[model samples]
Target: MSTTYLNLARKWRSKNFDQIIGQQLSVRMIKNSLYLNHFFPVYLLAGQRGCGKTTTARVFAAAINCANLDAFQKNPRLTSLPCLSCESCKAMEQGNHPDFIEMDAASHTGVDNVRQIIEAASLLPLLGKKKVYLIDEAHMLSKAAFNAFLKILEEPPSSVLFMLATTDDQKIIDTVRSRCFQLFFRAIAQNDLRGLLVEICQKEEIGYDEQGLQLLIRETGGSARDALNLLEQVRFSSDQITEENVLRVLGCISDDQICTVLYHVFSKAKSPQKLIEYVDEIKLESFAPEIVWHRFIVALKIAVWYKYGVSSTGLVLTNDLKASIEAVPLSQAVRLFDFACQQEQLFLKTIDKHLFLSMFWIRLWSMVHNQEAEITSLVTSKSMVTASIDSKLTVTDQLVATSEQQRVTISANSSLWEMFLEQITQVDDQLIVSLFTQAKLKNYDTESNKLEVSFHKKFELFQDLFTKKDAPWFLLLQEVFGNGIQLNPVFESESIVQDVKPIEKKVVDQSKKQFYQSNNSANVSKKDIPLDISDKTAWAMTHALLERFPGTVTEFKEETDE
Candidate 1:
């Protein structure tokens, strides 16, 4: 006759407090309570699933009723308790202890079940000194059932001990929770979890790769049961556990594959067709779309972290892949991460997951491609200006030219002043050009060699670029116009009010009036102001809006009280 095979999770279930993994605090507290011989009438164990709450409860139950618990506690050197050799411990381990009753509150959530437990609790222990009731998923019990058992739970007989284990403690009534001695179990740490898996693999005679085990550890998400179950699945699928086999069994993409996709997306490639080809080549469609998206999100998040030099020890990336990810800008990585997160909700709701995923890849490629094109365009323009400046004059030549020009007095309205403005326009910086071009040459005193440049109040925030001596724009200005020229920057009202002719002002004021009237009138259509108006401030405002927004202006009615 053949014996039935047991899976790794059940085969390796924690038999005692010592065997329990990743819950040292709870185990120590329970053992300390056992040593003092002080037992709480009601004990509450709460945590996420598979973090050893239920296991610890069972161990505590067995230890309290063990025949040799007193002998084990008396010795300081022996840390292991429950004395598995004792008959009570053996019976509890075999699930045949009469004094120990284990209940699944999830199945028995009604008041009738609570009444039966209450009646059972009224009786004394048959096999041991103390009777223990271990309730798993205690949070699933209905409010009525909790109420029915509250009296017994609050003040159980001295011979009976009640242990309640739940993933969610909040669902349990506050009165019951207040009565119990609560112990929270935290999720297992990754290092401790990895050690556990390594030990299990060695004991089971399972061959494994480091990367394969790391993947298993990640997939487990700090659950020992999940880790063991996943390991069993991988072991049964293949004799030797490897990353390739893990991916095959899980039907998920590898980190390298994700890095490859990110590389192509962040690369100079314009089309996503290559990405589609690569996906088809890898047979990505065979993998679950949800899992693919989940991995993609996680990979992007890791890339963002790596880009910032954050310590990401668990991320298994090749050196080349790491370099590629680090090569991408932090802004781009953050944007991709944010976009992926935003699309996740939509992706889950989408029925055509494959189509949505393909489009997602395309959108990512488009974002990077468009951003790259813009950057390239800006760089090209700046590079051309830089080359022109470099070819025209050296730093020494520029100083000489400025000194020569300074010897001759130049008025604000003179041709020399226009040439100075033209020289500023030739500088490689766009912000300097934009600001200086918008500025009005307020005055130029030839005696003091002082140049007063005034800007509209709207542009006041940029005054530092011109006033600061160490600023790049200021240095460039000095290099071009000579160090003797003192630049005083000031903010004033629009130049139209101070400089425009009376007739032009009237025309602009009328145009503004008509603009506001059009916006206020619901029946009227939007009308374009005449381009011939010579109000530089108005034109500057219009040009700024057009350049910044790059769209047609639509009329919106202003609300008014009747």
Candidate 2:
């Protein structure tokens, strides 16, 4: 019945042509039409969500009505500021206005609805100069409805005006869209969003850090509505907004953490399966893999650009990208960037991201091999740096190892490639046994320190699931092999373990804390083990903690904690 002090979104809703941000092209065209005093039969506004197409149309309608907003208190209308004293504006505000109609195409998508509206359009405006029709989510209109709307658009009545808003224009029938003057709405940028959020926070007297605002802007992905909602959540949680709160509330992974993981995974030879381990966690947070992957490619591109001293503020690269590009090499950085782009294309078009990732790692390892090849070929063929080459090889060999014992000891020096191999050979060998049985290891290079395998499946998850860190098998591996040591499990025939334990667990009256099977196999719970951090999940987590977080994990198996 009444208006409340407008929230950030409504309070700052665009008033006129100049108020809308980052939509210069749309604004210019619309304003020119208004100034020229020429009106299209139908005006279609299309783009991604929260881009303010509806606001502009409202403003245009209000201006036409010469609506005064002051009469309605805080509820201001853009047209003539929507005259509150006028019966027409009052009716419109009440949504009972005969002259102003708001139709949600999503609900009224039937042809009958379009026919009714068209029939109404034949008559003159009862309370205003021009009858205004605002159809939201126009893409939802049915085929017959679209045909009716199209015929109307193709031969629109002079007294009627139409504004169609949609998040996706492609879904709208081409013939319907063709008759309307189309204006595209784009996602607002981070900086603009930051400034907007700051202004709103100040207006609302909500305290927030610039960093918090920045995070909200980034996490909201330039949707004004989403950003405002997040800002409101921050305000409600605490007057003071912190980065921690932003991450927890928005479930946004910081650029730093994402980059750290990206660097470790993309720079060196690591399995894409490792990335997938976090996918479910991310999905639970409502994060899209396609978006995250695209964002990562942007980060890699920025890193590449930074290495070359050429900065590119490209699309998909977020606000945190520039800082991440520091200290990277041009060729490798660019290679990774290109790889990310290629990977994104594959992920978007085909579900075969696993193969794309495996190929990527193989290619990166090739670079190291190529480095050695270049040196050796230069030394032998050109007779140019044989001594230097020999010395480098000596160091590499040392780094490579002291003996086969040390060479394949499940250490972190195996470039992640060999680390994976070590797990299968000396460790559980069960998971890899399955993969190797099914996989065709077409190539293995001692010098390159890489392995190539192929699978018949088209989806990436086949390879990813087999080696994901959260997978039950991963817990088993981390318990056996450690962290930083990757395990790229390719799918193969299931490793048939015939080494049956001599125990069968039969239900017996409880006497012992643990039960022994007929095969002499013991199935013990964590209770049987010492306060036993014996669960595979917990064990894997502990190892990860020790690796990723150093000083915090000081000592392992501290006498009592178990």
Q: Which is the leading candidate under TM-score?
A: 1
Model 1: weakest 10-residue lDDT segment is 407-416
In the range 1-562, model 1's lDDT, one tens digit per residue, is: 9987878887888888778888888888888888888888999999998888888887888888888787767873565677788889899888899999999999999999988888888898988899999999999999999888788877789999999999999999998899999999998988889888899999999999998998888877889988888888989899977888888888888877887877767666334667778877877788888878888887777778887778666456666667666655566577678888888889989998988988898778755553334334444565578678775657786677555443332321344345556777655556667777777666666457677777889887666567567766665555444456688887988662334456678899999999988677665443544345246455655555565568655444444444
Off by over 4 Å in 2: 1-7, 10-12, 15-18, 67-87, 266-295, 312-562
Q: What's model 1's TM-score?
A: 0.66
Cα RMSD (angstroms) for every candidate in the order listed = 14.8, 21.0
- Highest lDDT, which number? 1
Query: On residues 1-562, what C-alpha lDDT tens digit does candidate 2 reach at each position?
Result: 7866656677677765556776778877775565555788888998877878788788667655644433322332333344445676566555577777888888898999999998999999887778999999999999988887777788778888999999989998888877888888899877777777777778777888877777777777778888888787877787687787877665555666556545534432333344445433444234444445555666666666666667664433333443433433344455556555665656777665534444554454334233333233333553335445564456655554434333332222333333344445543334344544444433333344444455445323446455456655455444333333354434444443433566544533342434433225444232222344446555664654455347433233312222
lDDT of 1 at 175: 82
TM-scores for all candidates: the values are 0.66, 0.55
Model 2 scores a C-alpha lDDT of 0.61
Q: Specify the poorest-scoring 10-residue window by lDDT in model 2.
A: 553-562
